[model samples]
Target: MTTSSNSSLSDVEPSKTPKNILLLAIGSMGDVLPFVNLGVGFRRHGHNVIIAANTRFRSFVEEKGFAFREVNWDMQHEWENTDAGSPFMFDFLKQGFQKSYSNSESVLNNVDFVVLGTGAAYMYPECLFRNVPAAYVCFYPWASSKSYTGAAYGRSFDSLQWLPFQLNVKIWKTIDQVATFWSDVGLLPIYNQRLKELGLPPAERLPWLPGGAFEKNQIPVIHALNRNLIQIQKNPLNPLEIQMDYPSLNIKEELKDFVPPHDLVEFLSRGRRPIYFGYGSMHSFSDAESRVLIWLEVMSLLPQNQRALFSDVGNIKMKELDDAIKSGRVFIIDHIPHSWLFPQTCCVVHHGGSGTTHSVVRAGVPSVVVPHFADQPWWASILHRLGVAPNTGIQANAITTDKLFSALLEVLSSEEIQEKAAKIGSKIKKEQKRSPVSKIVAYIEKYWEKTKWDVLTLDDEQQKVKVKDNWRQVNGNCYGNRMMNGNDDMQDVYL
Candidate 1:
């Protein structure tokens, strides 16, 4: 448990508190929802939190009673149009960042602190130039470490585990380079242009080096994962990482006064608890019709007494499945908050987005994760490791009716898995009662306390002097120099 010198900053109290915080969250609903919960926490504590996300989330963000800024990226459109296995996913992400940078400068001008998501790391160099304290909010582990396989790659190299640590690191670095090459090419030019406009030197054209954002900016990271689900091992690579419980905004209480559709309510009452199947925003399959057909086949294999609730949130067209909807065995819904619905279900099956994974886990329901891309497979693996899902779950490409039926039957019949899930759900409920937001707020305040003195006490000339000194220190080391030259390709090594 060795600590850094900045550990003292954890105790400092700021002379001036940061009132305005801009959280730039640019991804799927899964990515944005957690931040929305965090923003609610910030607002409760008297900070004016503005969530800058895709325009599609405007109503969702505004409904939460916080200021909303619209970024140019639409996750729904990208998800529906892009293939899950496309290498262009990283390029698309980079474009989103570029668009965000162009539109968010005005919003950034007013913010006292900036919190960015994992995909928005391109903003860190600019945050450094502006001297605004910034922290990264990651839903998954982004830093390079030896404790686990890199989350970005979504697979482990078990055969390479016997290799030396340095060799493993190099292998991981090479994998990242191949994965993120297009993203780097698309993003670096735009970022360099922004730096030039700000009267700063252009940043290095670095590939997406794991943990480079926090390392380069010397800021803490608020990781939004429960330690109970995923234990945080000390990453010798990045010491400033803070693991907090998942921030869940359960909307069930708010919906208590409201009424569900009459048919849906009746369906819930008529049968034993139904199984839920929804992919949320993932459109990995070729088309909605094909997915529905496969789902129908899978549902036919279920016991006569078991009903199913199918969500048509992404590309799935519920109208096309009129026979299933009319039969009363299956109910097709546009969208329902998982927090409100998952507990009522016997089990859940879906594309394993982080939000969906956490939601079903908290609901204490067994899961059948049909992973598409990105961290979905990794999360499915976690659920399996936790005994809440079948082994390895089901990969998207390999999903057949038989495989789906087998996996679903195994979980549904396993009393051990059910009991384990219930225990995990109990733990999650206990954690939810203990507000993760308050702890995060306190940590942010401490960050301000540590840096505010220097930022406030220095005169114009002294500030320039301090900036120069800090820049020299930041760029002096071999690692720093490599980062500056875009040569540092830090990688996570797994045993």
Candidate 2:
């Protein structure tokens, strides 16, 4: 198999013992799992690893033999407690922002490095100010042009989709201003002073930076994503590439008993080819009753020959499952590891969370995505565009039994969809060439070994000079670029 340069990074020998690592993701298990894998890989290589996330997964994390720090981001409770469903979802995000800021205040100063996901990085301003070296890992390909967040966070409606880029810039500008304002209020005016010292224009208002802009401010950032897939036409500042690849549970057969619901054997034996339909962590269907009715209606339309598994884990009550059970081909399960369950499935229907999207795709199953809010729609759009699935609008509410049935048939019946899915699956397999854990570990080792804490300083003038000299030598070795090189050199000097 042909391997890319990124895959080769992990193979480099380390020159020093690795440092303790902290990974903070305050979302669902899907949001936290890949980092978990990375942490596990770190520990395996003899570094201490700690994961901070929602308490819901505390037991799961400890059971995996890792330290679990609780993040009181009550995402689920916020939804359930909200008076209005859809609009209250905005409050839900605000609540998320608050919790993330608080969590960062508590942990940023202590960690050697931090790696965060999207909603998680909303707290990044804290880490950044704390002088912590950090990485932002966007699990999915970006679609928007926002400076920090990509189109992945924007609305799916074509009209509103363009708004994130425009709005986010103003919002980030505001956040920067807020940071400057808070600096005047508190003794830590270092960041604000630095802005002034650099002779940059003062921000109009407080920057909508993650975390209250209190703390140290000297962190270097490493973005981790696939650059090609990021939206460029939509947002011009799209060169950032962060690490991709979701973490695998790597749960062995022996560990099956430790997984939830206490009915492991029965869950596994239910069927070898059950289609899975469960939104990971985030619940898109606020109208539980309508969602259940739609789910029932859609399941009824699927061919009797096809078996499926439904997890109304966050919505529909267990007692309301009379119809779901009557459909002999469908099994209603509470929870099962998607990593394990997806491969046995003929196909999947899901809320396209980045983690779930990659897991199912890695399993090589043709799937359908009925997105529910936020990034899910972006995933649905991409997967639909990729032809492995039909983008059947947002949530089951927008999809009728006819729509659902057609989508199901489209993936299951179409040999073309199956072929395309297999082709995409092969590409994903190639993409997972090297484990992210190893690459991250290698990066840490190299950076630490060379300068130790000296690398912490923002100054790299000497290194910059050496890099320029080496580039000049390399240019001299290559043919016919003296004039063009002179232009680039002049531009670099001007910049």
Candidate 3:
């Protein structure tokens, strides 16, 4: 709908042929937001884009005026209580998957290709069933080899870094298999059952990444990251993967101007820039006690004249935080674009999520990372390794008030850290001109070539098939597409 005057995707126009691209964006707000960013990229490139995600995000996706399909996964609950149950609980995850596939007559009817997020790999069989080629995308690496791996590998194998490279690779890959052991166990039976129903052969087991189905087949697997900022341990033996700069809002989406609330604007107009603290979507009731204690200490520790902003209010109310907010010592915000807010911050202290890490760097400010789990610790280490953050960072479970205060002070005062962050930020801003999304789109179009026919008809097909027609009253909402069963998965293909 709008474009930045210096848009990169505009520089290299999309091919004459437009595609209908379906994306699997299943996870928390942090996880699903990137896919929304990418979906808009495809839309700008003249393709029909559909985002399939959790029902919670239906309105979030539909607000962009794109067709949304629902597929359920309580990622937050899983992260909150890791020891409680499998993410693929039979009664929960299985039913959601089965319903989506049964409803595929709508979303998959004319979808040319899909971009699979890590959690949505189970949808591979459905893609295969519908004869659609799919690519893999993530904030971090996906397959494992002696050379490259997901950040979880590094966190699990950091102690054995002194071992031989190949041996370390084996350890990390083995750890990956072990880490995913439960998920693989839970997913295989359900996955195979779906494949059987599709008349496809059952898979023996899950691959580290769909058994390298996408990469080995030359379907691109993209890591939307800056290789320059994070030194990913590399090996040629790993499956071929492309590393690109993180997708930027102004560059990729050219989204409408961000308008901060008048009160937030007043807060910003103050002479001193505020410190930002956002723990992302990792809010867990299990750790809420400790999380609250840490916040209480943090609020009390805010320097006398300095300001701070928190993403949202903590669940168990804190008198110190409450008083601080009431007195304008802190501000609570929701849905403010990081691209707009980060530049105004003096510095950021946040959970080391993939998006927030890059956002901090791109904002050209120093940071203090408080990593919780998964790829988080690795990101903290990466920021330290790059001299953009103070140290390997304080883990959330292990964090102490003193350690946090020291880390914050270091990031705030260290000229070296600020300089490095700014330089990387400037470099990343310049390199975004390369347009990773363009490269991704080009690879799909060039390798997975389809004919130039209208939506229903493919050139040279034995039969000219007309797909289920438009506007099928989706779950009491007129979303201009077939609705999902019970208002979850869209009954029709995403555009």
Every candidate's lDDT: 0.68, 0.53, 0.63
Best by TM-score: 1
lDDT tens string, model 3, 1-495? 001122123234335567788988766777788778777678877889998877788998998778897664555554565532232344555655665566666656678778887666667666654556677677775434455344743362243557876676666655555545555566667777876676555554443243333422334456678777654443222233456556555533443655569999999997588888778786553266566566557657867777888775556577766787787778877668887888889788887888888888888888888877667777887788788888876877677888887888787788998899889888877877665556666654543443222333333232212111110111122321111112322111111
lDDT of 3 at 168: 66
Off by over 4 Å in 1: 1-4, 8-18, 87-90, 156-190, 202-213, 236-238, 250-259, 283-286, 313-320, 453-472, 478-495
lDDT winner, 1 or 3: 1
TM-score against truth, every candidate: 0.84, 0.67, 0.78
Candidate 2 Cα RMSD (Å): 10.2
Per-residue lDDT for 1-495 in model 1, tens only? 012354534556632443788887877888788788789777777788998888889998998788888877775577666665664565666565566667656657667788887666666655655556777877776433544445565553221557875676566555555554544566667766765665555444431243343554457777777776686554445556667667675444435555677877788998799988888777544466767777888888888778888777355555547777777778877767677788999999988877788889989889999888777776887788789887666777788889888998998999999999999998888767656666776677777666553344556566545554554444344253343345645433211
Q: Give each model's clash number.
A: 0, 23, 12
Q: Order candidates by TM-score, high to low.
A: 1, 3, 2
Scored by lDDT, model 3 comes in at 0.63
